[model samples]
Target chain A: MAKKAFNPDIDAPEYKGKYSPYDIIKEGTIAVVVVALLTVVLAVLFSSPDEKAVTIKSWSNATPMDFAATAMTELDGSSGTATYGPPYNNAATGQQVGPLTLAKWMGINVNVNTANDFVVAPLSTLADQPALTSALTTFASASSSRRANWEANYSKGLSSGSFSNGVLQVAAANAGPLPEMLGALTAMARSGALDQALVTQKGFYTTDYTKPLLFMADGSFLANKAQVQHLSGDQWGMMNETGSYPGQAWLWLYTMWYQVPPFSTSWGANADALVWAFMMLLTLLLALTPWIPGLRSIPRKVKVYRLIWREHYKNM
Target chain B: MTTEIDRQWTTRLRKRVVETLPPDKLLPDTQPAYVASWIYVFGVTTLAALAIVILTGCVLAMKGPLWWHLSGTGHFVNSLHLWSVEIFFFAMVIHLWGKFFMAAWRGGRQLTWITGVVLFLTSVGAGFTGYVSQTNYDSQWISTQAKDGINATGGGAFFNVLNLGQMLMWHIVLLPLAAVALTAVHVIYVRIKGVVPPFEEGK
Candidate 1:
């Protein structure tokens, strides 16, 4: 009789050596019970972190001057939201990866007109006040240069301005109708109407939060809160939890890129795009490790499997 | 003479199933003695954690996001979901490390190894979307920060984290479904392939 050729895929040789009874259901049930008990105990002892959702109402209430100042920035088109480019607007060059213009490639899909969406549109809803109505009309009717001049002067005045009792008191300036419009906008925000207006689209669901977040991010208030919570980009914010709790440790590999040079310091480094692309490559390499010539050899070379199955080898 | 029924699609499928997984192998009551190791336990533990995660997630969905904020019971459920996810990743990483060291991909089981890695990648998406669905300051911050990276790759147009509706659906429906499907495939492959053998000094 001819002997069968060795087939590495076949496990008959290992199966022939020894076998032991294994109750998979019993093992699985015990694991489930242990995990469930652990989850319940942890849940009861340390509920979840439920930091309240930040809204225009909370933000304006917390720092009214910052709110007023941010409104000025929005009108002058100086805020980060105004010049973010692509999905929001096209005022400045966005981040890039190598020679690829990534932000430009996805050009303005969300079509956010920062001035219109962030300030004008939300404020326009409260047209009951004659002063606000007139301000809106005047601001809309002004020439581009005149509007720019008005916004610039008003923005300069805001540096020394103070907010009190729902009113923003700034030094007198040639600011068209900006101050009155902003005052009314502040009242609307204080009443929580601005938050509602920013999100309430023509739909049954009202969950879109782009405008409100953009408004908050342009000012120092939200970033300040984030820094206190250790959620800043430079702080490996993506991998952190709100308080001192466990975070997504699997994300360490992805977040580590942001700490290194080129991603961290290079002016043109589209850290987001570059990091995402690099992660994709890494994930692919991981998925194909068995086929990669050098990588596939590492497992055999390390000889760690010997330790894992040491008992089995000893028995043999 | 062999009949046409011999080549029928169902017959062929049944034959393939039997050839690949005989009943004794598919639902084996006995494992090779080499399977005796503590490291082997992590895989089942990860699966257990996943079950808890999914169960807690379902409870959260039933109550709605706002309800969870107001109710104490909701907080506990939310915590369970969070910690289960934490534990899931913890156990999964250990499982991955153990398997890698053991060269579990040997014996023509490369597909099983690849599926496991793919499942890990899918789970990351599921977890990130869960963060975006939290509807709190963290959600706000994460969505804004994550959008920059996604937009850089031109994914911002479709996968806008700021769109709560999109993220919620992905977290509760789409991504979870994919993760579960990938997991099922991974487990089925393991059943078909059987556990890898211990390495020896020579072939």
Candidate 2:
């Protein structure tokens, strides 16, 4: 195919107008220096938030019962990760946009088995202890009915506020080996080994934090901390900075969807999917504003350009 | 039909480069007096903020996230990186609005406009990745929160926000480099195009 001629008139419009000597280097240098000073002054006046990272160890230590109960939820396949279909598991239906099953189409790529990944596997390393080993054996070998009964009984005990001294003080009946498992898991978590255990991957480096993070999300501990910082979904959290600081204000358009209408109130509203789709559509709209009939006309309709280059348009 | 000289990649590229950005066009010491508008200053300010962000990011990269958490100087540098980014986005938005009203995309400078818009989009991704890489509670909350949206769009398979190493590399290496390169191209186009002839008297 032959290329079109590069017309100087169209490609590079000739400039025949007033000119001013502009020192690009000097202007750039001044801007940089001014910005650097501003950054330094802001940094000195208001230091960045250094809130320590939340670890499984801290979560388990501070609130063992929540950690233990959350573990039980993971084991029974009732936790967020357990039921979070697609890219993880299929316990629950994946998100959709109208008839389009967006998440299910992506499929389960991360492959998280909440029962094994979140609980059993992490506890397997501690099998040297007779109680834990026996508990694991009992839990693993038990029939589905028996395991379910045990979990139900333990969960009931938990609801009754039977926990005493980080040990769930459940009545012996129907509890089976659940107490042993929960006790051992709590101990492991408090000892800070749970953090290491959760991240223990196939390779020498254990950087992928999917397992640990999923486990955290299953519990209210992390969520509560976020709420304290005003970083919750309903709080326009995605754009908020920690504490009283202003967050990524540019995200308002994206986060605004979460605060209103069908997204906030609809039972089937996959907020994430809906928001992502909306933003993408909006971005494309903005990018094509020049081509879109009404949007393209907005610049001329507003006439703000006259104010911007008032000096140039003065003769009009 | 192609000669060896014409077929050479460097020769073709050089010719195009020089033709498009001749000496004066590439580095002009003078600009149209119509560029006097205060709105023009925001673009330069945005670039200035980006420079600070990159410099502070480099320092943070050298010492790692842990050092930034513990050392006072590291904290200050990290803060600088954060604030610079805040300013970068802030100024860029203003510049974007200003140019939009001016119909800066007029003439054959559509590529220039497109590049600037794309640069802003990439910077948003870069900023989000930076937040996720902070290794603080904020990062934890944000990444886990963000993963849902990304995954819903089928981006989780590759762009796993929970993966610290992945997000870190993107923040420090990939996104920044893409943004910087795009910014360079955008600025070159601006220079070559000679800052859209201010909307004339009648048309």
Candidate 3:
């Protein structure tokens, strides 16, 4: 077969009556300018980052007993996230399932023994202080039930408590060596010396103690309050901010899934697994949309693209 | 016989012209109309936001993560980068759903659709590593928590979340590269195929 002659003008039908390259460029430049201007306005007005930091010492000096009770509560299993199953610590009761079928496979891997990591370990560092060391040891050796009773009374007393001259005073009925022990712990935290104690064990240490460090931080009263302020976990949604600072408002969609029932109330690995599953489903749907029935036909139903290029269509 | 040969040549020429011209340049008889819609802007706007994110992110990487700790300008730049990411993901989600409603993946643009989906996933990974690199208390908590999840699902064996060194490498190197590459592929497909024409006129 012979080669056919090429005619650019004859083939380029779109250029017959449409806008030229320069015209398209001009329009595009305008669009870019408008977007850039809007971005600048938004940035200038909402220029804030969630960068607040709360240290152990800050809390120890400010809210002493809350710190002590937090330390003690970690020694108990009362901290909200203490028993949070899978990923953080291994508490079998913390695991969740739907009806049957491993519903979720992931389980606790962080494995934080709150009592040992938060309470006994930190106290061990202050062993040179005989009074604190002895009190911690006694508290450690006491029956679980006895310790629980004491903690319950102390925690209750805290509800009606007040701070005076840096000392936290509660009802005498809930008083004893516990308050003094707490005071010493508070001092240790304020001095910033407690971080090492909480992190490092008594003897030679080689293990990566990141888990213990996280546990201590999570179980800390200040950390809890900060998380609350930030609207973390179930109590709050993604839109709320801690203080006047802006948080991850972009996470509204991801966090919204958690607010609804079943997911909101689910426990342990199941909750995390469900979230992952929902995200996966969404991605897959977006990916395979061309093949899906109802979704694949929506472009025709709403026919607004015609309006965007209405002038061009009118001329055509 | 010569007239018949001329007609045959004319038919061949028309076929070649149709194949060589851009889809948008073809006559309405052969080119499908993309009946315009508001949803169309969502995808393009998302792409625009992502372009900003990549530009700002590159500047931030050049300055290094500690730049925020160094001076006021660096901190401002870091804040801008952070906000860019926040906006990028926000626009991305909107774009994803807009495409969903329009079923913009129909016709022969499946590759474009898949590339977009991959880009979204990679962006999430990039966002996560960005958080981890912050080295703040929130970073500390998310890293440890996410590590546990990753480990349970067997992702930990390869991606050690506890290794700040590894996390840093992934954040600055691996994930961003994947995101940019996937986004490029998505754009190429979109340009080559043009937008998928609207579904059949009535439904």
Candidate 4:
């Protein structure tokens, strides 16, 4: 028949005895003031936008040959994004990860043929030029190794090549139908018509990786001329530069992981897997901290929370 | 005699129960043993940063996507938004790590821990959406590239990166709402349960 007594320990000290509601309001007011001050300080100092003009028209005009070379290089699987697996393009079955079962479960979703999409498709629009058209058709039909050999030869030739009055001339041995095809592409680029070719796609127009990757990769050309004036991977952080503007510096943590040798030199897919694994480990550590022996002891070890409630503890 | 005995027994039982209660339990006298100093402000600092993000995000949404390119005021507002986001994630990461090391989720507060993890995931989603809505050439590229990953994983059917309209809607409305909702629930639970008393005190 006896009633249970309410335990006072269950009540917060701030709610007890002579403490007024104003005490809570006072703490809240201080917090608000601190936040407002910080926000204003950040807004004033870093307010300038990083906006710089970067359009396809401007870029193609500035570096026509470079653009053409890039387009051609992509056609030969030497472009940085050419063989980027999974998200950008589907890897060949042999190049795919995991056993047959897992690979099949995921499947090859983002199917892309860099040579076809980045080169042949665009050149198809320019098929009226019989000579250039024939070169593209021949290059497209050639074996991958033969194309690779040709590009390798051409790329090597460019190392010692010279330019005269906007004309790039390489050794006659390296000068083949590919160089002539590149000339037409360069002329098209200089006129700013290349943008149209780069973006124009067939089918439902669901996805266009060409423009974005091109926009990122072509700093030697026009679009990123102002923003990513520096073409090194370190300067642009392995992604597209957003005008002249600052970008996600927080990504430093992620990109820094790549700057090291093993990650930087590893195969593209393997590097991605490494980063993904690292993130997974971090997440798991965070989730399991409560049960982890050394981690669970940290609060008591640090005793920082005692300082957080010092005034209350002082009275006690 | 029976009525008197019953009444006496009830009175005795009540007194015994009162006496058995620990003195610290009877009075709110046991102080929190964790640090209660001004340096603990980082936790609240993070929450403040999230507040800035929400407020600036609201203003930007009211003006729409082209605002950053439309007027000087709009551009400044957009700058504020970008800075707020930078600060929010920065603070969130620090706060999350601090909590992790402090074992702040101990003593039957697993839900708080899980909710924090969910908030982190939601924030990343929000960040990705925000990046896409920038509408720059970079935004254009990131969206197209990110779609491949999303599509490959069968997430494209639900979350289409190329659909600017869909992305803008999620960035402004859906994802933010989910983030705020999750945060609110997390906060309420924390307040109700109160901070887990220092680990050693139980031992």
Candidate 5:
């Protein structure tokens, strides 16, 4: 084959000078050992965090009222997942980036009915509970307005309920079958059945935890735990670990934007879409830095490479 | 025989491969003197960390989640996996910074830089999924929080963060496959282009 012509603009500077002996295998071996040693040292110093997953049983046992109240919201179609639009349901308009409702366009692929999936369906599986069974049947047959009325007042009454002695006692009139339904659900949660129940509703493989996690998210259990660990969105939780161990430090640049004015304030529900879009745009800009005029010139203008190759420069 | 060689696709491929990278150039014994830099080591350091990460992850996967949570050896391997991943990202960031500051893309290596950036993005996905597949509170909380951001872009349509099976497959199989392949291409480009020379004085 003939030698190809080299264009100075895109070609590497043709090296006619003396080259230095370099053992790439030796260098690579040293790096592998050094990096592996560093990893072992870090791992020994700080073992990874494995905080016990918050099961529905644990949540219910700890804060029964929160469980009951959230269960009511799920029934009323007012919980976070209940109103979470697209991929879950159509209760609300999904997040939008300016004009593009990408989530809405994606549609309800998960098909979560918070009421059925979170509460009724799980409760329906419980055998030999006539009152609970009756509540499920009545709740199912009742008008949407009547069910909403029942769930609302029960939710309001849940504000003062005492969940002591493994019992939920609320004093809300017109509560109808809710006390029975929620009470049964709370017991189901406390027994650890709800966790399996929520997951089992999806499949036998038991892979997806979306139902249970969504239900738990509606309550304060998950967030409360997160708050103690400084793992909330406000705390740059995306870059956080459970304890003092290192986290996803690469995401700091990404999560930093949320703390500023736009994402934390006016953007509200659309904040996620906007932040995601902005990060993508920034990544594109970073990738294309070689083509961007001032960005590309920064390396030469700053002369950082001169310092990197100082030995060669000194010889020159 | 010479004419027959030209007609064979396999022979043509072999010729093309050798043409692009002859035996000596593919694994050179000498490099440009300007390649001497502490920063230049980071690329290999990142690669080393990734190897450890994969090794630890394979061990963890072999024993399953319950074993990792229960057995002391499993726990240590899990720690190794986590720390190795952290080191991988740490070294990757340093390498990226070093490459950027050195203008490594100068010698028609734009594809190298672009692949690296895409590799970084792929890595972020891999890391995010690893967190989501931990089967612990961190996974639970992260999935819930990340789902909103994910769904906002309809990423949840396919890559449901809450789906542990899906995330585990992606983390272990799909993303790693992509990352390793991209790393190969990136390194091949580096070898082909040679270490980029420093900018000409004052220009």
Candidate 6:
């Protein structure tokens, strides 16, 4: 019984011409051996990367000023993760792909209040500090606009601030209690208490580091490390791994869009949604190419299959 | 008991399965002579590498992140897993490229092509999750970076990349299951359809 062929214009007729000896089980066994040996050799030559996760303690201890500066941004609600709407909060309008704003439509699910999660709550965890406790209360008592003013004033003081013996020396005028509060918070970050305190999930399995990563991302410390490792988005980081280790090279086409015109320039803000949309469209086309007229004809027009079937054609 | 077995659903399913892919076609002593190219071997190569990936992954899973980071043998196993994944995708892509040129979708094999596409996409996803589940600096950077794209597409509501437990579970379990299932379906399609006939020139 012969089967009906697909579209006559493009699809080749069912092959009934020739047969030859082929031991599939033997072929498969050889392949397994060959591939196993290849991977083992590659692994031995170039092992994987495993740089340890950065803790808040390391960040503070190594660069106390960077931690303090980042803490100030978190307190003032001016950091990247603080304003990273949708999954985090409704800080800004979520991403839009032309008419569709999918991020906004889904709404906030992670519910990260950067000020409390990154700063105040960590300070609140300290065992017993009278001045820190009083500063928290004073800051909590102030109005939103007043707090903004105090934050601005402290930010001004940070420009000329100095630290020695784990104490920040920011000028304390209209800054209100921020000097006292940040002093305590910086000390907490250094003690590694801030890292644990930020893990506020009320569960025994508190392995999710969403809160801490968000806080870390808001600071330049992590980004600095990423730059050194050649993992920044603009550097085609999607296809990169730390050091010389091979990355997700399979993501080449997906990540290449970031380096091109609109993604690199005009549409930077909406590039994520658009690039995703574009890749999806391309994938759909690739999947449905058999049914597509011009695309299905490419194999015939290109004649690459001739090379693939050279021996058969040679006999013919 | 013989009569009961003859009337069983299991018997009917067995008949149907054998009918679809008989022993001869499933493990044939011969394929078409046109399947002589080196390009044809990558499909099996890919399958082999995928097996290595799973085996190494099982070893890594047994010990968990701490051991993989601190212990030397753990690092070697982790390396095997990573390199196997690299080879898996490498060979898979080559297979896809060869199939595309040969138009393996001809002769009612469109579903076969689609399955390969799905497998490729799923494998890429599995690779992505694996990167994010390392519980290392790579995980930290990749998760934070990938979250935006996921969030922008409104996928973050369910798939929170920042959550290590969630990402690790998906990496080790969910995505691998999907990829394996898709691979099974893809291979079954190949078996049922019989390896696609070579592109007949001047058809």
Q: Can you give the DockQ of every candidate in the order shown?
A: 0.62, 0.60, 0.14, 0.15, 0.73, 0.75
The C-alpha TM-scores of every prediction are: 0.94, 0.94, 0.69, 0.69, 0.96, 0.96
Per-residue lDDT tens digits for candidate 5, residues B39-88, read 98889999899889888888988887668888888889999999999889
lDDT per residue for candidate 5 within A136-183, as digits (tens), equals 888889998998788778888898888877889898999889999888
Tell me which of candidates 1 and 5 scores higher on TM-score.
5
Report fnat for all candidates as fractions from 0 to 1.
Answer: 0.69, 0.68, 0.14, 0.17, 0.76, 0.77
lDDT tens readout by residue for model 3, B1-203: 55676579788797675665554542222223433455555555666666666676677778876676666776666666666666677677777766655455654567887898888778877777777676555555556556544543435446656555567788878987888788767866766665554332222
Per-residue lDDT of model 1, residues A1-316, tens digit only? 9987754322224456788899988999999999999988887777778787788898898898899888878877888878788777788567677788877887777767778887898888775588888899999999999999988888888888888766888885798898888888888898899888888744456877777887887888878988999888889888997888767778888988899987788742577888888899998999988777778667668888888889988887
Worst 10 residues of 1 chain A by lDDT: A6-15
Query: Model 4: per-residue lDDT, tens digit, A1-316?
Result: 8954432222112233123122333454676567766666777876744344344555546655465567666766766556544334554322222332222345444455666765566667775788987787787687777777777777777556655576667664644567766666556666666666665575434334344344345335432443354423445443434544456655555556656767578545444445445655876776676667676566667776555445655565
Sort by DockQ, top down from the best: 6, 5, 1, 2, 4, 3
Please give the lDDT score at residue B185 for candidate 5. Answer: 93
- Interface RMSD, every prediction, one decimal place: 2.5, 2.8, 8.0, 7.0, 1.5, 1.3
Top of the candidates by DockQ: 6
The residue pairs in collision within model 3 are A86-A107, A86-A108, A304-B36, A304-B37, A305-B35, A305-B36, A305-B37, A306-B35, A306-B36
Question: Model 6: how far is A104 from its true place, Å?
Answer: 1.2
Worst 10 residues of 5 chain B by lDDT: B194-203
Poorest lDDT segment (10 consecutive residues) of candidate 2 chain A: A6-15
Candidate 3, residues A1-316, lDDT tens digits: the string is: 9955532211112223322232333433554455455555666767645454445666677667667667656656766446554445555433232453221244444456777776666666675788877777678778777877777776677667766776667663643356656567667787877766654564555324354445445545534665666655554434454456555565566667766777777453466556655767886876776677666555545665455556456655
Docking class of 1: medium
DockQ of predicted model 4: 0.15
CAPRI tier of model 2 = medium
